[model samples]
Target: MTIKFRFHPEKAVEAAAILLKLHGKPMKYIGLLKMLYIADRLALKTMDQPITGDRYVSMDYGPVLRGVYDLIKGQPVDSALPLWSKYISPRDSNYVDLLQYPGNEELCEEEEMILKQVYETFGHLDPFLVEELCEEEEMILKQVYETFGHLDPFLVAEWTHDLPEWKDPHGSAIPILVEDVLRSMGKTEEEIEDISQEAQREAYLDGALPKIFG
Candidate 1:
């Protein structure tokens, strides 16, 4: 049986918020989505768990986190849980702006560091920007804007395509199982079994303990 981790929208929101804070302005939704996916993929490989626990899928762009994608598009979701719209603006011309600061209480130091490093590696590097006379204008234009008049989403997508776990889904999408990723990373079957069981246990705690304790 395929093992799946429960998606936590709160963590997803907090993760995206951290990236947005580092971005310091509106970002193309696609770019933000790619950054999140890369971070989660890295987390899974290193820590045996993804940060948001969102379902993964392979699409034309690359591997995507399904729940986070839905949240980015502002689709109707469980209202009881924290909505992505609470902290991120509705899509405006395919770009999303951070609406407010969703506190990072759910994120550990390592997760936050992963997010920051992903942004640095994929998003933009301002240190390479050419210095300008006007300080404010330089700050605004410090980051390189590729074809999209901002961070180039396509470039980020191209990089994500290189991940071994991502397969070309042609015109359709395909689910990417967590086991698939672990195996691609050369994890032994025994190690994968242990990780999957741990994931199931974590899911149970997240779902059952709240009701039992409350």
Candidate 2:
């Protein structure tokens, strides 16, 4: 019922609010879409769902987000489909178009500045690649990290002892399944990790796991 979407850095939250209020907000913002996915996979694993890391992937955000928004607006969450139960399966895209302009160019300079600052505050931005990530989905997981890091009073009080790596949104290790996604692509492990970390956030967020989308 309490759906914590993305890592809420003070600035990212403010900038995103501006982005949504600009004209109209999408059913879900892009970054939230990404985090929603990582959260889904983590939920599946924690519940001991009958699925392997290779199977339980994130759900499609566009339709899911729209559906949930309408459902939450009308009926209770329990009435809606168990999104996790259905979409929980293995996952692994062409996304060059999204990478042309990295980050949220939709934001104004002032807004952009704030979002970037928030990204840095997180220790790093979306560093994992869409294709090369392990089952961990580190990029999306970053949101959960940021949200708790920002909003959780416990985390705030224990900042020095709690390093970023010590946290995971789904309460498990990240599944950065590099070899599986790029196995056919023939990328080496090192190359894949580099790509996943350096890949632009926009394309990575918008793109789906290759196995599903392809």
* RMSD of model 2 against the true structure: 19.6
Q: Estimate, for each residue in 1-214, the C-alpha lDDT of model 2 and write its tens digit.
A: 1112222122222222322222121212234323232233332233211011222122222211333222223333343323321221111111101111113322233223322222233322222112222232232233333442122222222332232222232433232232333432355666545544443342355456664777
lDDT of 2 at 27: 18
Most TM-score-accurate candidate: 1
For residues 93-185, write the lDDT of model 1, one tens digit per residue: 888888888565566655666666666665663211111112221122112122112346787888778888899999788999999898988
Model 1 weakest 10-residue run by lDDT = 127-136
| lDDT, candidates in the order shown | 0.70, 0.28
Judged by lDDT, which candidate is best? 1
Q: For every model shown, what is its TM-score relative to the native structure?
A: 0.84, 0.20
In model 2, how large is the Cα lDDT of residue 210? 62
